[model samples]
Target: MNMNEKRFEEAKSKIVGIQRNREGIGTLQEKTVHAVLKNYYAPDVATHEVSLHNYVADIYTGNEIIEIQNGNFYKIRTKLEVFLEEHPVTVVYPIPHTKWLIWIDETTGELSKKRKSPVTGSAYLAFKELYRIKPYLKNTNLKFCFPLMDVEEYRLLNGWSRDKKKGSCRYDRIPVALFDEVVIERREDYLQFLPYELPEEFTSADLAKSAKIPSQTANLVLNILHFMEVVERIGKSSRSYLYRIAKDLG
Candidate 1:
């Protein structure tokens, strides 16, 4: 949970330089967050934006493909299926463990108060995106790397609504610190993500309560758990499917 102070400062310094170099284009922009992390992880790998099996990957080592997805997993589901058959793929997802929001004024060019967002994220947040690619979770060649980070989000006014500040577009997300990473290669690795005190027999409702997450998120996590075979459908609890941890997982 603790990030290296020295490395984080260096990364932030580098991002400042990147932002300076890319100032004031406004409409068009560079992929600063993705580019910086890519370089940080794999500096030696120069073959970025690579073509493999007719699919374009973010970065490629000679033996593996790295896809940086800061948005949605569903967008790359088809590409993952095609590439996983022939090459190992690591999906690098960055979750903002802690976030600060910065809003800029369009007309006056004034920077508003920089406030910390109330949302604090965890490794479990990755499941939100993983739900869309549940079927590919158990693939031998597939792996997920979630970098838990502290980020600064910069927003600009869109000028369309009464609440100008609220109707802004998120223009940049600068990774201030990389606290830790959760890497899942095998289905068993997912066990650590689950709550230690999950009931012997539980539904999504039970999981939501046990894990202290929303029912919607619990449902998504359960879907992935079921797909990865960590849990199974034992029976039905009214409209909900009841689940129990697999014996192998237990």
Candidate 2:
């Protein structure tokens, strides 16, 4: 196994060991994915859940802060603002590169056969969450790490649809494997998200096609990029707005 794979295994084992010994630890209340990442990033328990300026950081490596956010980014905006004033903060967001769905019958507690989801995830999906914290994207001390993981998602078979699939509540996610990561530290690192095939001047539709993401998502990506000054609105094309990578991004 490669270094990442080895580290992942070690992280998983550390979480399992902690759970076995301390069942009701306050930090253990977080989902397995979050706990594993905390271990993966900062193995020293002393650094996990450190208090800084009245805010609890997921992991503080003495120099930098690492936050594992599995849900809404808005919730951490205040904490991030506090941390960013004095220290560099790296937000770790996990996207399921490959997902398997397992539905649990709430009534009988029986699990359905695991099936692979047709939807594959990419770093572009982060735009949705990033949009919530748009004002902080340009901060020099702020960075992002998108870890693509293979996971099994457990959901309850309680939804509005006839098959109880639509609007189902997610029980938890079990990380199966680590695929790769997209790390963005510098403003130039944002360029990695843009598709190589993109034209000099493009609309969200063109971006959506090249990035293989939905147009709505592409719009969000552009919004964040524009706010960061990575992209600028050059003009208009029909009903769509045209955008170009900023000339000073080099």
Candidate 3:
């Protein structure tokens, strides 16, 4: 089998193992999203709910801490700070590049409809939440991992929704495939995410146009870049700030 196919099977196997182990649990199993990833990344090398520094980390490998944050990163801001003090911490955030939406009727145990979502996700979305943990990105002991995966989104009908699909409640997300892993180990590594077409120095408008992202997003991207010391504001282009990569960094 090819390398990608091998990795795909490996990831799928991990999820299957987690499911088999949690067969008879009454309450929820610490979010299926987190369990699957913890198995995939640190399969046999880590311990779960390991306590250290007065905080219980999701997974610890004696030397480093790995937190599978399937939701907002802001919630773990304070906890992350405590871990970063003495040990390296890796935050794994999986972004679904392609998703299949499965709607189920709450009244009956039946699948109503299964369709692909028109909207696809990218690594860029990670930046939206990264803005909240901007200060932590610069820590030498901190790292961010964005795993692009193909996921199945389960929705229930009993929830209220204004949208026609009635996506009132999200049951769970199952990661079926792993495409690529984006690891940010250093502040300079973030520069690789920038567009090749970008000028040496440019405004948020220029970045927005070239990157095909909203101006507001461009602003947030710049905000994090500035805080990380990757770029510095040289001047102002009317209302927008002009920036260039720092001389010594990246």
Pitting candidate 1 against candidate 2, the one with the higher lDDT is 2
Model 3 lDDT per residue over 1-250, tens place: 0125465567566565554423311136665567777767665744877879888988898898988887688999999878999899988888998998887665764665668999788777788889878778878898888888887777776655554355377777777778777888888887865788989989988888887878888888888888888889999889888889899974
Ranking by TM-score: 2, 3, 1
lDDT of 2 by residue, 140-176 (tens): 9999998899987878889999999999998777777
Candidate 1 per-residue lDDT, tens place, 114-139, comes to 79999988778889888888778778
Clashes of each: 0, 0, 0
lDDT of 1: 0.78
Clashes of 1: 0
C-alpha local distance difference test of each model: 0.78, 0.85, 0.77
TM-scores of the models, in the given order? 0.86, 0.91, 0.87
Name the candidate that leads on lDDT: 2
Query: In candidate 2, how many Å is residue 161 off?
Result: 3.2
